[model samples]
Target: MTANNATPPAPPVPSDAVGEGLKAAFRFHPAGVAIITATTDRGPSGLTASSVSSVAIDPAAIMFSVTRATGSAGAILDADSFIVHLIDGEHAELAQNFAVSGAERFTEAQGWTMRETGEPYLPAARVALRCQTLHTVTVGSSVVVIAQVLEVIEGTRGEPVVYLDRAFHSVATA
Candidate 1:
Protein backbone atom coordinates (compact mmCIF):
# COMPACT_ATOMS: atom_id res chain seq x y z
CA MET A 1 0.00 0.00 0.00
CA THR A 2 1.18 3.51 -0.75
CA ALA A 3 1.78 6.02 1.98
CA ASN A 4 -0.97 8.15 0.48
CA ASN A 5 -3.41 5.26 1.00
CA ALA A 6 -4.79 5.28 -2.52
CA THR A 7 -7.05 2.40 -3.50
CA PRO A 8 -5.60 -0.31 -5.75
CA PRO A 9 -6.71 -0.45 -9.35
CA ALA A 10 -9.73 -2.58 -10.23
CA PRO A 11 -9.74 -5.08 -13.08
CA PRO A 12 -11.31 -4.04 -16.38
CA VAL A 13 -14.84 -5.18 -17.15
CA PRO A 14 -16.40 -6.23 -20.47
CA SER A 15 -18.54 -3.63 -22.22
CA ASP A 16 -22.06 -2.98 -20.83
CA ALA A 17 -22.49 -6.42 -19.21
CA VAL A 18 -21.68 -5.30 -15.68
CA GLY A 19 -24.04 -2.35 -15.99
CA GLU A 20 -26.87 -4.60 -17.11
CA GLY A 21 -26.15 -7.02 -14.27
CA LEU A 22 -26.30 -4.23 -11.72
CA LYS A 23 -29.65 -3.06 -13.07
CA ALA A 24 -31.25 -6.51 -12.70
CA ALA A 25 -29.35 -8.09 -9.81
CA PHE A 26 -30.54 -6.29 -6.75
CA ARG A 27 -34.22 -6.65 -5.93
CA PHE A 28 -34.93 -5.25 -2.50
CA HIS A 29 -37.84 -6.04 -0.22
CA PRO A 30 -40.58 -3.52 0.53
CA ALA A 31 -39.64 -0.76 2.95
CA GLY A 32 -41.24 1.98 4.99
CA VAL A 33 -41.13 5.68 4.20
CA ALA A 34 -39.02 8.27 5.97
CA ILE A 35 -37.72 11.78 5.47
CA ILE A 36 -34.03 12.54 5.85
CA THR A 37 -33.47 16.19 6.61
CA ALA A 38 -30.40 18.31 7.32
CA THR A 39 -29.80 21.81 8.51
CA THR A 40 -27.28 23.86 6.61
CA ASP A 41 -26.31 27.52 6.68
CA ARG A 42 -28.37 28.08 3.55
CA GLY A 43 -31.41 26.40 5.12
CA PRO A 44 -33.01 23.11 6.05
CA SER A 45 -33.57 20.59 3.27
CA GLY A 46 -34.94 17.06 2.99
CA LEU A 47 -36.21 14.30 0.74
CA THR A 48 -38.92 11.67 0.79
CA ALA A 49 -36.90 8.51 1.19
CA SER A 50 -38.09 4.93 1.03
CA SER A 51 -34.70 3.41 1.81
CA VAL A 52 -34.38 3.84 5.55
CA SER A 53 -33.54 0.69 7.54
CA SER A 54 -31.83 -0.46 10.70
CA VAL A 55 -28.35 -1.77 10.06
CA ALA A 56 -27.69 -2.71 13.65
CA ILE A 57 -29.50 -2.35 16.96
CA ASP A 58 -26.69 -3.08 19.42
CA PRO A 59 -24.57 -0.19 18.15
CA ALA A 60 -27.67 1.77 17.15
CA ALA A 61 -26.98 2.43 13.48
CA ILE A 62 -29.01 2.85 10.34
CA MET A 63 -28.26 3.25 6.64
CA PHE A 64 -29.80 5.19 3.78
CA SER A 65 -28.62 6.24 0.36
CA VAL A 66 -29.13 9.64 -1.20
CA THR A 67 -28.47 10.52 -4.77
CA ARG A 68 -25.42 12.74 -4.91
CA ALA A 69 -27.61 15.10 -6.87
CA THR A 70 -30.29 15.24 -4.18
CA GLY A 71 -30.75 18.59 -2.46
CA SER A 72 -30.68 16.98 0.98
CA ALA A 73 -27.25 15.51 0.25
CA GLY A 74 -25.73 18.93 -0.27
CA ALA A 75 -27.12 20.09 3.06
CA ILE A 76 -25.99 16.89 4.82
CA LEU A 77 -22.47 17.36 3.50
CA ASP A 78 -22.43 20.80 5.05
CA ALA A 79 -24.21 20.17 8.36
CA ASP A 80 -22.80 16.67 9.06
CA SER A 81 -25.96 15.93 11.02
CA PHE A 82 -29.44 14.78 10.14
CA ILE A 83 -32.70 13.26 11.31
CA VAL A 84 -34.89 10.49 9.94
CA HIS A 85 -38.62 10.81 10.52
CA LEU A 86 -40.62 7.64 10.14
CA ILE A 87 -43.88 8.68 8.53
CA ASP A 88 -47.31 7.49 9.54
CA GLY A 89 -50.40 7.34 7.34
CA GLU A 90 -51.52 10.72 8.64
CA HIS A 91 -48.51 12.23 6.88
CA ALA A 92 -49.53 11.49 3.32
CA GLU A 93 -49.46 15.18 2.48
CA LEU A 94 -46.14 15.56 4.26
CA ALA A 95 -44.63 12.78 2.17
CA GLN A 96 -45.91 14.39 -1.00
CA ASN A 97 -44.39 17.72 -0.09
CA PHE A 98 -41.01 16.21 0.73
CA ALA A 99 -40.95 14.13 -2.44
CA VAL A 100 -41.33 17.26 -4.47
CA SER A 101 -37.76 18.27 -5.22
CA GLY A 102 -36.59 21.90 -5.26
CA ALA A 103 -38.09 25.04 -3.70
CA GLU A 104 -39.32 25.38 -0.09
CA ARG A 105 -40.73 22.46 1.91
CA PHE A 106 -40.49 23.56 5.53
CA THR A 107 -42.26 26.82 4.90
CA GLU A 108 -45.66 25.19 4.68
CA ALA A 109 -45.22 22.37 7.17
CA GLN A 110 -47.01 23.09 10.44
CA GLY A 111 -45.20 20.99 13.05
CA TRP A 112 -41.57 21.08 11.89
CA THR A 113 -38.54 22.33 13.76
CA MET A 114 -34.84 22.75 13.11
CA ARG A 115 -32.62 21.24 15.75
CA GLU A 116 -29.41 22.84 16.99
CA THR A 117 -27.39 20.73 14.55
CA GLY A 118 -29.58 22.09 11.74
CA GLU A 119 -31.59 18.92 11.26
CA PRO A 120 -35.32 19.07 10.73
CA TYR A 121 -37.82 17.19 12.88
CA LEU A 122 -41.54 16.66 12.97
CA PRO A 123 -43.70 16.48 16.04
CA ALA A 124 -45.98 14.08 14.18
CA ALA A 125 -43.49 11.43 13.17
CA ARG A 126 -43.92 7.95 14.62
CA VAL A 127 -40.17 7.84 15.20
CA ALA A 128 -37.68 10.66 15.00
CA LEU A 129 -34.00 9.83 15.11
CA ARG A 130 -31.20 12.35 15.56
CA CYS A 131 -28.10 11.09 13.85
CA GLN A 132 -24.38 11.68 13.65
CA THR A 133 -22.60 10.83 10.46
CA LEU A 134 -20.64 7.64 11.15
CA HIS A 135 -19.63 6.73 7.61
CA THR A 136 -20.30 7.70 4.01
CA VAL A 137 -19.41 5.74 0.90
CA THR A 138 -19.85 6.71 -2.73
CA VAL A 139 -21.75 4.35 -4.99
CA GLY A 140 -22.12 5.63 -8.54
CA SER A 141 -24.34 8.74 -8.37
CA SER A 142 -25.48 8.13 -4.77
CA VAL A 143 -23.83 8.37 -1.39
CA VAL A 144 -24.64 5.75 1.21
CA VAL A 145 -24.72 7.24 4.68
CA ILE A 146 -24.51 5.04 7.77
CA ALA A 147 -25.32 7.09 10.83
CA GLN A 148 -24.92 6.51 14.53
CA VAL A 149 -28.25 7.22 16.12
CA LEU A 150 -27.76 9.75 18.90
CA GLU A 151 -31.28 10.59 20.03
CA VAL A 152 -34.49 8.66 19.64
CA ILE A 153 -38.02 9.96 20.15
CA GLU A 154 -40.80 7.45 20.27
CA GLY A 155 -44.16 8.85 19.30
CA THR A 156 -47.66 8.18 20.57
CA ARG A 157 -49.24 5.01 19.21
CA GLY A 158 -50.19 5.06 15.53
CA GLU A 159 -50.11 3.03 12.34
CA PRO A 160 -46.89 2.84 10.32
CA VAL A 161 -46.72 4.43 6.86
CA VAL A 162 -45.32 1.95 4.39
CA TYR A 163 -44.42 1.79 0.71
CA LEU A 164 -44.81 -1.35 -1.33
CA ASP A 165 -45.46 -2.11 -4.99
CA ARG A 166 -45.01 1.59 -5.69
CA ALA A 167 -47.95 2.43 -3.46
CA PHE A 168 -48.48 3.76 0.04
CA HIS A 169 -49.77 1.38 2.70
CA SER A 170 -50.67 1.76 6.35
CA VAL A 171 -49.90 -0.82 9.05
CA ALA A 172 -53.31 -0.54 10.73
CA THR A 173 -55.27 -3.63 9.75
CA ALA A 174 -58.45 -2.84 7.87
Candidate 2:
Protein backbone atom coordinates (compact mmCIF):
# COMPACT_ATOMS: atom_id res chain seq x y z
CA MET A 1 0.00 0.00 0.00
CA THR A 2 1.13 3.55 -0.76
CA ALA A 3 1.74 6.17 2.00
CA ASN A 4 -1.69 7.82 1.65
CA ASN A 5 -3.41 4.59 0.52
CA ALA A 6 -2.50 2.60 3.61
CA THR A 7 -4.60 2.54 6.83
CA PRO A 8 -6.88 5.43 7.78
CA PRO A 9 -5.84 7.87 10.51
CA ALA A 10 -6.99 7.26 14.10
CA PRO A 11 -9.74 9.37 15.61
CA PRO A 12 -8.79 12.35 17.78
CA VAL A 13 -8.77 11.78 21.53
CA PRO A 14 -11.67 13.31 23.48
CA SER A 15 -10.67 16.19 25.75
CA ASP A 16 -12.19 14.53 28.80
CA ALA A 17 -10.48 11.28 28.00
CA VAL A 18 -7.19 13.09 27.51
CA GLY A 19 -7.65 14.86 30.83
CA GLU A 20 -8.40 11.62 32.63
CA GLY A 21 -5.43 9.92 31.01
CA LEU A 22 -3.13 12.76 32.05
CA LYS A 23 -4.41 12.54 35.59
CA ALA A 24 -3.79 8.81 35.70
CA ALA A 25 -0.27 9.28 34.34
CA PHE A 26 0.56 11.86 36.99
CA ARG A 27 -0.94 9.89 39.85
CA PHE A 28 2.10 7.66 40.01
CA HIS A 29 4.61 10.51 39.96
CA PRO A 30 4.96 11.83 43.51
CA ALA A 31 5.17 15.60 43.88
CA GLY A 32 5.90 17.84 46.83
CA VAL A 33 2.88 19.85 48.00
CA ALA A 34 3.15 23.56 48.66
CA ILE A 35 0.83 26.43 49.48
CA ILE A 36 1.34 29.63 47.51
CA THR A 37 -0.03 32.47 49.57
CA ALA A 38 -0.60 36.12 48.63
CA THR A 39 -2.25 39.12 50.22
CA THR A 40 -5.46 40.46 48.67
CA ASP A 41 -7.18 43.71 49.38
CA ARG A 42 -10.02 41.67 50.83
CA GLY A 43 -7.60 39.63 52.94
CA PRO A 44 -5.14 36.78 52.69
CA SER A 45 -5.70 34.02 50.12
CA GLY A 46 -3.82 30.96 49.00
CA LEU A 47 -3.93 27.66 47.10
CA THR A 48 -2.14 24.36 47.29
CA ALA A 49 0.02 23.48 44.33
CA SER A 50 2.21 20.45 43.61
CA SER A 51 3.69 22.04 40.51
CA VAL A 52 6.20 24.29 42.25
CA SER A 53 9.70 23.87 40.80
CA SER A 54 13.04 25.63 41.04
CA VAL A 55 13.82 27.40 37.79
CA ALA A 56 17.13 29.21 38.37
CA ILE A 57 19.87 29.28 40.98
CA ASP A 58 21.74 32.54 40.32
CA PRO A 59 18.68 34.70 40.96
CA ALA A 60 16.97 31.99 43.05
CA ALA A 61 13.76 31.68 41.05
CA ILE A 62 10.86 29.28 41.35
CA MET A 63 7.81 28.60 39.19
CA PHE A 64 4.32 27.26 39.77
CA SER A 65 1.01 27.33 37.91
CA VAL A 66 -2.34 28.35 39.29
CA THR A 67 -5.75 27.99 37.74
CA ARG A 68 -7.27 31.32 36.68
CA ALA A 69 -10.52 30.66 38.50
CA THR A 70 -8.88 30.06 41.89
CA GLY A 71 -9.78 32.65 44.52
CA SER A 72 -6.13 33.41 45.22
CA ALA A 73 -5.19 33.71 41.54
CA GLY A 74 -6.16 37.36 41.30
CA ALA A 75 -4.23 38.32 44.39
CA ILE A 76 -1.18 36.34 43.30
CA LEU A 77 -1.21 37.83 39.83
CA ASP A 78 -1.67 41.37 41.10
CA ALA A 79 0.71 41.24 44.05
CA ASP A 80 4.38 42.20 43.93
CA SER A 81 5.36 39.08 45.86
CA PHE A 82 4.09 35.96 47.64
CA ILE A 83 5.18 33.10 49.88
CA VAL A 84 5.71 29.42 49.05
CA HIS A 85 5.30 27.15 52.06
CA LEU A 86 6.56 23.61 51.73
CA ILE A 87 4.05 21.53 53.59
CA ASP A 88 5.05 18.43 55.53
CA GLY A 89 3.20 15.23 56.46
CA GLU A 90 2.14 16.78 59.74
CA HIS A 91 0.55 19.75 57.97
CA ALA A 92 -1.47 18.00 55.28
CA GLU A 93 -4.59 19.45 56.88
CA LEU A 94 -3.25 22.92 56.27
CA ALA A 95 -2.66 22.06 52.62
CA GLN A 96 -6.22 20.78 52.28
CA ASN A 97 -7.55 24.00 53.78
CA PHE A 98 -6.01 25.99 50.97
CA ALA A 99 -6.59 23.35 48.28
CA VAL A 100 -10.32 23.89 48.36
CA SER A 101 -12.19 27.07 47.60
CA GLY A 102 -13.50 29.46 50.27
CA ALA A 103 -11.44 28.23 53.21
CA GLU A 104 -10.16 30.43 56.07
CA ARG A 105 -6.47 30.13 55.32
CA PHE A 106 -4.63 32.82 57.25
CA THR A 107 -6.64 33.12 60.42
CA GLU A 108 -5.13 32.87 63.91
CA ALA A 109 -6.30 29.24 63.90
CA GLN A 110 -3.74 28.51 61.20
CA GLY A 111 -0.94 30.21 63.12
CA TRP A 112 0.53 32.35 60.38
CA THR A 113 2.38 35.66 60.25
CA MET A 114 2.83 38.35 57.60
CA ARG A 115 6.05 38.41 55.65
CA GLU A 116 7.93 41.34 54.06
CA THR A 117 5.25 42.26 51.50
CA GLY A 118 2.25 41.20 53.57
CA GLU A 119 2.18 37.61 52.34
CA PRO A 120 1.26 35.05 54.97
CA TYR A 121 3.84 32.49 56.02
CA LEU A 122 2.99 29.37 57.92
CA PRO A 123 5.07 28.85 61.04
CA ALA A 124 4.73 25.08 60.89
CA ALA A 125 5.82 24.54 57.34
CA ARG A 126 8.94 22.51 56.63
CA VAL A 127 10.35 25.35 54.57
CA ALA A 128 9.05 28.81 53.69
CA LEU A 129 10.26 30.82 50.75
CA ARG A 130 9.40 34.49 50.29
CA CYS A 131 9.47 35.39 46.63
CA GLN A 132 8.84 38.45 44.47
CA THR A 133 6.77 37.94 41.37
CA LEU A 134 9.00 38.31 38.36
CA HIS A 135 6.93 37.08 35.41
CA THR A 136 3.60 35.43 34.68
CA VAL A 137 2.49 33.62 31.54
CA THR A 138 -0.88 32.17 30.77
CA VAL A 139 -0.62 28.58 29.57
CA GLY A 140 -3.70 26.53 28.72
CA SER A 141 -6.08 26.84 31.71
CA SER A 142 -3.45 28.03 34.20
CA VAL A 143 -1.07 30.94 34.72
CA VAL A 144 2.62 30.07 35.10
CA VAL A 145 4.18 32.32 37.73
CA ILE A 146 7.91 32.89 38.06
CA ALA A 147 9.20 34.50 41.21
CA GLN A 148 12.59 35.43 42.65
CA VAL A 149 13.40 34.22 46.14
CA LEU A 150 13.73 37.15 48.53
CA GLU A 151 14.15 35.21 51.75
CA VAL A 152 13.92 31.71 53.15
CA ILE A 153 12.94 30.44 56.59
CA GLU A 154 13.81 26.98 57.78
CA GLY A 155 11.07 25.41 59.77
CA THR A 156 10.93 22.19 61.82
CA ARG A 157 12.85 19.46 60.08
CA GLY A 158 10.62 16.60 58.92
CA GLU A 159 9.47 14.57 55.96
CA PRO A 160 7.96 16.85 53.30
CA VAL A 161 4.45 16.03 52.14
CA VAL A 162 4.24 14.22 48.84
CA TYR A 163 1.13 13.75 46.77
CA LEU A 164 0.80 10.47 44.91
CA ASP A 165 -1.99 8.21 43.70
CA ARG A 166 -4.61 10.73 44.77
CA ALA A 167 -3.28 10.67 48.34
CA PHE A 168 -0.58 12.25 50.50
CA HIS A 169 2.49 10.25 51.54
CA SER A 170 5.66 10.96 53.49
CA VAL A 171 8.83 8.86 53.50
CA ALA A 172 10.39 7.95 56.80
CA THR A 173 14.07 8.57 57.38
CA ALA A 174 16.23 5.50 57.85
Instruction: Please name the candidate that would achieve the greatest lDDT relative to the true structure.
Output: 2
Write one digit per residue (lDDT tens) for candidate 1, span 63-105: 9888888666778756767888888888766787787765457
Error of 1 at 141 (Å): 0.5
- lDDT tens digits by residue: candidate 2, 125-146: 8899988888888867789888
Best-performing candidate as measured by TM-score: 2
The collision pairs in model 2 are none
Candidate 1 whole-model C-alpha lDDT, 0 to 1: 0.76
Off by over 4 Å in 2: 1-16
TM-score of 1: 0.78
TM values, all candidates:
0.78, 0.85
Q: In each prediction, how many residue pairs overlap at the backbone (N, C-alpha, C within less than 3 A)? A: 1, 0
